[model samples]
Target: MHKRKISIYCYLVSAAFIIGLLSISMFISYSKDPTSSAKDDNQLEYVTPEEVGYSSEKLNEA
Candidate 1:
C-alpha cells in the first residue's frame, strides 16, 4: 500500500512537471511580437562607397 501511494505521488508530480513545461513553451511561442520581423519604413537609403568619402578601388583591394 505504501509503495502504491508513492507511485501515485510520483506519477502526479511527473505529470504536473510536464504540464508546466508545456505551458511555459506555449507562452514563449505565442508572446513574440509578430511585426518585429517586418521591414521598417525608416530604413536608410543606399549609397556608393565614394559618396561616403571612401575609395571604391581601395575597398575592393582589401
Candidate 2:
C-alpha cells in the first residue's frame, strides 16, 4: 500500500511538470508581436493597384 501511494504521487508530479511546460510554450507562442507576422513592408499600406503602377483593369482580367 505504501509503494502504491508513492507510484501515484510520482505520476501526479510528472503530469504537473508536463502541463507546466505546455502552458509556458503556449504563452510564449501567443506573446509575439502581431505586426511581425506580415511578410511585406508595404502590407499595411492601403493603396490601390493603379496608385502602385499596376492596372486595376488588368488585375480584374485574371
Candidate 3:
C-alpha cells in the first residue's frame, strides 16, 4: 500500500515539473521574437559595424 502511494506521488511530481518546464520554454521563445512580442519591449541597441564584420569607416565612405 505504501509503495503504491509513493509511485503515484512521484508520477504527479514529475508531471508537474515537466509542465512547468514546457511553459517556461514557450514563454521565453515567445517573448524573444520581435514580430510576435511587443515592439516597445524589444528595443534595439546600437552595435558597432566592426563587431559584426563590417568596417565602420567603409560604411561611412558610401
Strongest candidate by lDDT: 1
What is model 2's C-alpha RMSD?
A: 4.9
* TM-score, model 2 to reference: 0.54
What TM-score would you give candidate 1 relative to the actual structure?
Answer: 0.53
How much is 27 displaced in model 2, in angstroms?
0.8
Query: Using TM-score as the measure, what is the rank order of every candidate, best first?
Result: 2, 1, 3
Per-residue C-alpha lDDT of model 3 across residues 1-62, encoded as one tens digit per residue: 99999999999999999999999999987774665544565678788898889998899999
lDDT of 1 by residue, 1-62 (tens): 99999999999999999999999999989895776987777889899998999999999999
* Candidate with maximal TM-score: 2
- lDDT agreement of model 2 with the native: 0.89
Off by over 4 Å in 3: 33-62
lDDT of 2 by residue, 12-52 (tens): 99999999999999998888566685576655768999888
Q: Model 2, clash count?
A: 0
Clash number for each model = 0, 0, 0
User: Which window of 10 residues has the lowest lDDT sum in candidate 2?
Assistant: 34-43
Instruction: Name model 1 segments beyond 4 Å from true.
Output: 33-62
Global Cα RMSD, each model: 5.9, 4.9, 8.5
Please report how far candidate 2 places residue 44 from its true position, in Å.
3.7
Error of 1 at 15 (Å): 0.3
On the 0 to 100 scale, the lDDT of residue 48 in model 3 is: 88
Alpha carbon lDDT of residue 57, candidate 1? 93
